[model samples]
Target chain A: MKRNILLLLVIFVGIGFLLHAWPSFSQEGEEEAGYPTYPIIFTKPLKAVLFDHKVHVEKAGLSCEDCHEDIFKMEAGSTQQNEDFNMDSLYKGKYCGVCHNGEMAFASNTRCASCHIGVMGYERLLKKQHSSESSSEH
Target chain B: MFKGFADWVKSLKNEGVEHIASEERRAFLKLGLVITGVYAGGKLLSVVSRVREVYADIPEYVDKYPYKPHYSMVLRTDRCIDCQLCMEACRKTNHVPPYGWRTRILEQHLPSGEGQWTRRFMPILCNHCNEPPCVRACPTRATYKDPETGIVKVNVKKCIGCKTCMAACPYDMRYFNEEKRAIDKCDFCWESRLSKGKFPTACAKACPAGVRIFGDLADPNSRVYQLVHDPYRAIWVLRPSMGARPNVFYTIN
Candidate 1:
């Protein structure tokens, strides 16, 4: 009876280990769900209006899969922001710079005052310039 | 005493004849006691080991979110193309490497006897349950649900990436990010988008079939809440009887 009980215990543990056989299982599932968010850094002056993707999706009679297209359906915080977002390079069509370069999506040069107005997180850029001007004035 | 000890072991080894002859009716009690003592000792050792586990990867998020029986994304079966756009969209939105898929659309072809083509499409992702089993299996506090949004999230930065939550999950929703050596899964796009003042997951946003709907499950005015509350709508979850009490709802046509 004692040996049988030990064997039963061993079976339970064996089942548990078998149940958790895949080491990459949970993480693969988690990654599929969305785990970590890779940080993005900007190397160029390419800030757009805070596009509330939800407004167009839920309230505006649009589906969630529209504006996001292909890229929006990616993992969280994994977007590459530092990719060169310039107009000359963008005009040829690359990243957000390509279409937003003025012809296809939105104009890059024509929107200086748009993002530069401060609501687009470019206020920090302006503040730095302003402080530099004041300091050089002295 | 040493001679006596050797004699006892020798007797046990040669037990076929002498042991059987020596055994009496009362020997059963002695065997029973031995078995119970062994069992008790094992239990004590296991409890101690569990208590002393330093880097146990348990879920610390069970105490975080309040329970709810509704979910956000609803699978509209009739509109599904089995294209797996949602799965691709989720990867794009999250930048998930090709190691594994977080969301997948399952296709089932009916036997060709009905004189009509019937392909069943099932889009599966984490159901963000009111009581997620993955939350219990984690020995470390890596997996947890968000309080404000009620979405399940893992602290990938802190996770040792143990597969405990995967075992604990009845829906088999949890996944691992082998590249980062951590766990990953759906946060309903709420943790990254909604809570961060944005909205629409990549899967929900890029859904060409318009089969998936992402909304706040909390507010009555939210599209997801309305969908969940719809009396005529038939909502379903994977293994609804498992008692995980998931918040995700689906409209299977």
Candidate 2:
């Protein structure tokens, strides 16, 4: 009976890890109702560049197909690993510059503070997420 | 020997070139010509004198401002993300066609250390210069500067589509609009929005970064005025040598 309890504990811990690791996959169905308020964080050139999907889609009136399969991939954090994933790429009319250019949107070069969010904004988001997670557990 | 030295000094002073009459010296001074650099007759001097004549009527820069509501734009160039929201807003507000753009962003790259690179973006549009070349070049007076607001506006009714304004623009901002059959460029959104009581231009309103600060330069409280007038800020305009005296200013900060 002791062996059985240990096995169950291990199984519960593994499941918890899986849920935490893949929040997007687990929360996909729920987020559909909320619609595009998700903040995507990128770690490059420095940690925590926040891209708000809600502002682009809901406020700016852009569709999913507008960015997907063209400028960026559907998978999150995939572009960060690419060799040309930095500001250089964006300036060349790739990535975010595809829309952010003054011709299409606000040029990426003009507003460094708005979307850069920086490491501080990243930490704040992380803290908010941690507190929410702990509170939810309680 | 002392008497001989004094006599020699007096003789040297007497031998000096004849002094000009005081009235002649006063007349030269009145012409604002310094003697050291002045040559009475030369082709270059004639050209310089004619150029001075052309500008002599113009008032000092500080006192030359004629517009009451001097519409101006200050661009914070470093913060641009190159999102095209402003472009879309312009098109929607002004009905700009697919082939034409009133404003555009230019990208430049500089190599940082460790094989990394830095990207910079600059947005360009009609500068609406105080001495607009486009307005002066237009034969039909199709493009003219609004005296009250200091905005360069295209009178489509008067435009013959000679494209003189397009060629004359140092910024290359004007384009011959096929639909309008006139050279169209940015008018600070005067007809579409400004005249309709909107404060910010379409592009400025759509800019998420607050990169484009648009306001009246005459207003001391306006951000545009503050940014342009700030001593700490490195403010500059494009191609200042062209003598456009652009109302639009750019700042790195």
Candidate 3:
């Protein structure tokens, strides 16, 4: 009976230990599970050509730079974003900054939905994902 | 009585050590099986999701939506006229920064039969591979393949800028973005328009000739899918010998 009680205690102790770790694990989120980012968002309304990353990459001979315009150099998960409150000042003559101007993605247009649509949402999603992801790890 | 107690204590100590050693040995064996079990389990889950699925570690580090290729870049080699308008258009449309030529035109010099020298231009970009080498070589789990759309992409967040994927690639398509410090390759244009349920790449739209076609490979209704599957044609991917098994199928005449 004593041995059985000790085994029961061990099981309960293990369960308690894991249960204690549950909330923290849940808090880690899924997107933050070791993902990289380039946080530089376009302050200007980038209303140029809508490009599909998967098709051109697979069907056409174009690589990433073929269109993203060397906004930043190709590094492993490079994320060097400058804080430019406006669009023209942010990307002018700097990679896509030259072409996307009001005419392209480098426009001086200022609309929260236009400039921050995909970027802001995507960034938030990544963060939320990561939090849940870290939790699931344990 | 003291001697007897001492002997009893010594016996307990010996038994404890023996028990610990056996437990450790058993634990070592259990560890091997546990690791194997995890790997097998992960593989099975991924396979069930169609081998293209990612096997995430405990951290769920796998991207929720891995890259899905969405565009087909085609150059009218004959209509190119060597003008490089396409190049400028691509650069302007996409912001392909300086010194990093994303669309490199291959000028094939042809000695005109009439003694007039002619050049045929072939624009080359990242050949999004079916079995992408860049995706395979990333150590930090930065590069990934989107099973839904067949697009291989890099997670700028996780990439350490090691350039292993660049070196691993065969077509020399992968570019190292020095400023941001990550290996850059084509992921269609999902990064910019991912939230809109849209599928368009800058290069495909910039072409005035309407030569480029972008679509889903899995969907038989897609133009590219029908084109690639056409039995009465000869289409080719760059460097088939590289074993990278690229998805970019160029219909060469």
- Candidate closest to the true structure, highest lDDT: 2
TM-score-wise, the better of 1 and 2 is 2
TM-score for all models, in order of appearance: 0.45, 0.53, 0.43
> How many angstroms is residue A63 displaced in model 2 relative to the true structure, after the best TM-score fit?
33
True contacts kept of each: 0.00, 0.22, 0.00
Clash count of each predicted structure: 50, 28, 74
Which candidate wins on TM-score?
Answer: 2
TM-score of candidate 2 against the unseen true structure: 0.53
Docking class of 3: incorrect
Worst-scoring 10-residue span by lDDT in model 2 chain B: B38-47
How do the residues A41-64 of candidate 1 rate in per-residue lDDT, one tens digit apiece?
Answer: 232343322333333334546453
Candidate 2, A18: how far from true, in Å?
37
DockQ for every model, please. 0.01, 0.10, 0.01
Better of 2 and 3 by TM-score: 2
For residues B144-218, write the lDDT of model 1, one tens digit per residue.
866656678898877888798988887677778888789888877655566576667778777655678877565
- State the lDDT of candidate 3 residue by residue for A1-138, as single tens digits: 999999999999998898778766644542353222223333222211222333334554555555443554454223234444233454455444454455644353322222232322445556877886676555
Per-residue lDDT of candidate 2, residues A6-111 (tens digit): 9999999998887666655646753774544456888764555788777887789988888887877877767777888877678888999888788988886665
Cα lDDT, all candidates: 0.56, 0.76, 0.52
